[model samples]
Target: MGNEKDSLRAKLSPMSYHVTQENGTEPPFRNEYWDEERDGIYVDVISGKPLFSSLDKYDAGCGWPSFTKPIELEEIEELEDRSHLMVRTEVRSKKGEAHLGHVFNDGPKEAGGLRYCINSAALKFVSIEELEKEGYGQYKKLFS
Candidate 1:
């Protein structure tokens, strides 16, 4: 595997580091902002590329985390995952290249029936309060 840990640390916070770097999962239902109803973007832990938005978020009760769609389709890289004797779509960050999680076809009808079951470790939420400060001011209209 490529050693992208150093680069990931520079872009993300310690908590994010623990998850992405150490492959740790944030406690279920106890994440810092898992229930955040704010309108904003969620980016990759390493490359800071936008992945998903609050608008596509839904409660899947799968434990880790889930999103309906990516903020930008090209920002994610999907690969055929056959790790556990099962065929699955493995989701990864296009830039950070970290393994985010899997994609499922069982989602709400309103969301095209696709669910991006992600790992909280692989994401960093950009709230409205920090969007402008984090160099993502251009996306402010997403909330407006």
Candidate 2:
């Protein structure tokens, strides 16, 4: 556990370590991807596993990067969260188990009505143009 923490600390920035490992939240609107308007795929920062695609991203007015859903349902695990004095469903990467953020029922009604509010610190975006070079060519289909 110590070795993993050490490795993670070395790989991730302080804010990323706090958000992904410590379950800390970054300030809204000031976050990296909160206002990102690019075409790409969002992968787990630690494990590099595909999580969300820019095709599903939308401005939910929550100051965080919001997605209608993951690239694949199997890529994430939603758990009941009782922290912060409010019951919510927590989103985490299946492989990395990084704390992504929460999912709420207040998303666009036409988009399945689920808001996956994610932390930018937990993800690394691979632009559509750089997908192949980033070894994420498979996700290019989302852009097409």
Candidate 3:
């Protein structure tokens, strides 16, 4: 088994750890993927599971990384979050078992109005520059 702390650290940046593991969030527009435009997939920060696709990404202007939808329903798990005197769906990576963020019903109408507000710490963006070199050559066509 991998060390939970080390595994998370290796996959996530320092800020990500604080946000995801600590149930915190980065300030708006301070996250890594908030304005990222790359070709590869975003994986789980801990276990490296492919969770969201760039195709499903969008700018929600919410100060965090938001996606229209997940790549697959089975890739993630949703729990009813009742914290802070509000009801929300808490999303987590099923493979990594990491706290990703939340899902909300209010989003762009074209994308089904479902915003998958995620934590940058729970994700690792694979850029086009490093896709092939990182053994993600199969996803190269996504950029084209």
Candidate 4:
């Protein structure tokens, strides 16, 4: 397991390693997926575990890829973050233990009252058409 994690860390880009391993934040608007609109599922870059879906994505005007919820509640693990002198809930990928981003209470009321402001470096988007080929065929039913 340790070797696998080391291999995964080595394969990640610098920004991705920083975000997921070191809890670093990427510049908001400049990051990928913040403005993406295509239908797809976002998975953990390290573990390939499904995290979010385009169906749950929304523009929160926060300059990040915001979602109402995870693809499945079990895929995420929340931890209390006291970094930078602010109390926040940190959301991480359960399987990969990658720090995805933070969750806030403010979000579209109709969709849900929580906003998962995720880091693009921690995720890889898999389009609906590519789900099967990418070994995520079971998730295709989400689009169907």
Best of the candidates, TM-score: 2
lDDT of 3 by residue, 1-144 (tens): 559778767766778787777667777787778888766688887776678878888888887788988876798999998888999899988887778999999988887989999987688888767878867677677668
Distance (Å) between predicted and true CA of 141, model 4? 1.7
**Cα error of candidate 2 at position 49, Å:** 0.5
Q: Is candidate 1 or candidate 2 better by lDDT?
A: 2
Give candidate 3's root-mean-square deviation (CA, Å): 2.5
lDDT (CA) per prediction:
0.79, 0.94, 0.81, 0.93
Error of 4 at 128 (Å): 0.9
Instruction: Say which prediction, candidate 1 or candidate 3, comes out ahead on lDDT.
Output: 3
TM-score, per-candidate, Cα-based: 0.80, 0.98, 0.83, 0.94
- For model 2, the superposed segments whose C-alpha errors exceed 4 Å read none
Model 2 residue 129 lDDT? 88
Query: How many clashes in each structure?
Result: 0, 0, 2, 0
The residue-level lDDT of candidate 4 at 14 comes to 89
RMSD of each: 3.0, 0.6, 2.5, 1.5
Q: Model 2 clash tally?
A: 0
* Candidate 4 lDDT, 24-67, residue by residue in tens: 89999999999999999999999899999999999999888999
Error of 1 at 65 (Å): 2.5
Q: What TM value does model 2 have?
A: 0.98
lDDT for 92 in candidate 3 is 87
Residue 108's lDDT within candidate 1 is: 90
lDDT accuracy of residue 90 in candidate 1: 84
